[model samples]
Target: MDKAIIDFFQNFTTSNHFILNNIFIFFTKIGNLGMIWILISLLFLIFKSTRKIGIVSLLSLFFSFIISNLFLKHLIARPRPFTTYDLKILIPLPKDFSFPSGHASASFASAFGIFLSSNKKSLKWVVITLASLIAFSRIYLSVHYFIDVISGVGIGIFCGYLSIKIYEKIMKNK
Candidate 1:
């Protein structure tokens, strides 16, 4: 199933539409190192009204990085789909393991953190939409397996919710 999904995406890579490929590549680039999400969190942090959500989002990103990138990736040691299969990669090859996509995890962690912490429905939807696109871009780019991204999404959401609970606990203690 994973190979089939990847092969299906390969069709897009071979398509004549450079614009569509560029859009997916753009999503992946923004997600790299979680730079865009980090910037968003910092913007949230700058605002007095959104400070708490910003803090939660940062914590979520941190925890997701630790769990997905540092720990689980090493533990699982799953190779990238491109490594296992002869797939065309649109981006530079990642050196790390591929069980959980760091991009997907970080994207969701930040987005879900905002969703849980903020009251603005529009903000939540916007962030979640971006997160979804980022996660999907991983699979579309063939850098990650479908299951790897799915796992990353689950882990990222869990990390996000966990960060919120931890924040609440700390506040209560204070």
Candidate 2:
């Protein structure tokens, strides 16, 4: 099923160079090192009302990064689909193990953190949409397996939930 989905999307890698180059690739680039999400979290931190959520996002993002890149990726060490298949990679080939995409992890972690801490429906939806796009771009660009991104999303959400629980506990103690 994963291979089938990748094969199906791989078709677009040839047919939609313009969209791939201009849009998906742009998302993929922004996901590099999870830079854009970090910037968004920082922006949220600037406002007093949003500061707690912003800090939650940063904490969750750090946990996601460490778990995805440090532990899970090393433990699984799944090679990218492009590693063995002849696929047109829109972005530069990534060197890390590919079981859990760090981009997906960080993106969803920040999104989930915002969701947990903020009451604004619009902000939550916007963050979710951006995170989904970042995760999709990984598979769209041949950098991750669909399963990788899926696992990343799950792991990231779990980390976010954990962070929020910890924060609540800390507040209660204070």
lDDT of 1 by residue, 16-97 (tens): 6588789999999999999998999999999899999999999999999999999999999999988888888888998999
Residues forming the 10-long window of minimal summed lDDT in candidate 2: 14-23
- Candidate 1, TM-score vs. the true structure? 0.98
* lDDT (Cα atoms) of all candidates against the true structure: 0.93, 0.89
What is the RMSD, in Å, between candidate 1 and the native fold over all Cα? 0.8
**Best candidate, TM-score:** 1
Off by over 4 Å in 1: none
TM-score of each: 0.98, 0.96
lDDT of 2 by residue, 1-174 (tens): 878888888888888668655688888888889898789889989999888898899989999988999999999889999987889887788998998989899999989998998999999999999999889998887778899999999998998898888888998999
> Candidate 1 lDDT (Cα, whole model)?
0.93
